[model samples]
Target: MDIKEYIVIAIAINAGKTILGIYNSDVDLKLDQSPLTLADRKSHYIIKNKISQTKLPILSKEGRKVSYQHRRIWSKYWLVDPLDGTKEFIKKNGEFTVNIALIENSKPVMGVVYSPVLDILYVGAEELSAFRIKQASELLKYLTLINDWRNYAESLPLLSTINIFRIVVSRSHLTKETLEFINSIRDQHSEIELISKGSSLKLCLIAEGYADIYPRFAPTMEWDTATGHAIINATEGKVCQADENNKESLLNPKFIAGAFNVDEKRINNHGR
Candidate 1:
């Protein structure tokens, strides 16, 4: 399907999440060991079915189990993380999001992140462009574009002589390796502040220049960060290799760095 059509589907599915998330408060809560809720299931179903119409095989967190044997053969496909922040959803923290990404040759080319509670949609493509759309008051009016959004981004001051950096960590899952990595940074940087956030919004904070770096040392599947990774890349930011020992093994499967003030060429090299 075309980009506009995909966006429409994303917004529609996000609206469904808003309805269900609100409704779920009155119903009995079923908390899985890993924070699964009815709203997550509902959103996942809506997005999965809607994207299925595009005729592309989907590898989704809530959909059918397709083996990598089949997935490895496809040139292009969809990667989805419907209801990304299930813990945040259950907590009513309003930080959860729905993520949809198009992966071409194991790299994300396009992505859409919709936060139902916030009524914000961030869309982008590696070849095309990126934009943030906010929902209008009139139900039929659709999304109103925010003009000169890049100007707002450029207005932010750059990092100069700061010895310490702000680091964003996962709220639900914290690992010892992640802590050790943070401590390692703390040894060099004077003061390290750890901010806890859920879902892809962590990447947004870095893209918006609120945070300096975000490192995920634990295991994370591709769909979990694809959309946010795309956004970080588009915003002239670098999600680079953290390993100091091996430069070639730059793209850390263990960690990701969202340095917003960095150059695009540097970030592009990280992608390689």
Candidate 2:
């Protein structure tokens, strides 16, 4: 059995369910001043327990800290954000997700991002390509049909696209640089739409071809972008540093994600 078809998908879905079960729990502040809730812990442990069977080391947002020196030695491992977009989850906006990715040699190779509230599941890998499953809560009921995932699962970056140049940005973390980047795009295109979204959905939008570009100039850890980066990578999209020549780091640098190449001028010129 494929690990993605069984273990990965099952764990994401179950974790999403666990998150929803305790939706209305109290929120606490983490050391970083970010919000934490019961759902985050519940989902983290659920994924931790299941993924542990894989025997690969895990680097999770909520798990015990693993230093970079130790992590640098790992050629491959699981990267997870059990509850992405806690703010959205708290707002009950149905825009949050549970993110999991496989990192090989510091690059994401496979990924799964599930939005439990929306019953949407997205899975992508070098071997399996990329797929978006709607009403994904019912996925378990048809486990045998996974080999034929293409029959029901929608392949990413859907064919139909709007004429408008859409730019998806984080609802909470739109930095001044991001706004200037959007303005730069507007300068070139007469019709431009700015989209406000939370969590990894911004990258997912690019993978789905709903948005033409996403400029992230704000702060984000590796776990925050790895899953989405894998999905974008699987779709033949590019997620790279603004300079385009700089290598990716643990804390991702200012970057642009898009299905097509974004002009280097726009990336380097923004809010610098």
Question: lDDT at 68 for candidate 2?
Answer: 64
**TM-score of each prediction:** 0.75, 0.88
> What is the lDDT of every predicted structure here?
0.62, 0.79
How many clashes (backbone N, Cα, C below 3 Å) per candidate? 0, 1
Q: Tens digit of lDDT per residue, candidate 1, span 202-225?
A: 876676566777777766666678
lDDT of 2 at 260: 42
Best by TM-score: 2
Candidate 1, residue 192: lDDT: 75
In model 2, the worst 10-residue window by lDDT is 242-251
Candidate 1: worst 10 consecutive residues by lDDT? Answer: 242-251
lDDT of 2 by residue, 1-272 (tens): 27454688889999998887666444433333233466788899999999999989988889847776777778888999999997777666778899999988767889899998788988888887888989877866676655755677898868745688788999988888778767765777879989999999999998887887788889887788888888988888777572211123556677888764445455444434
RMSD of 2: 3.8
Best by lDDT: 2
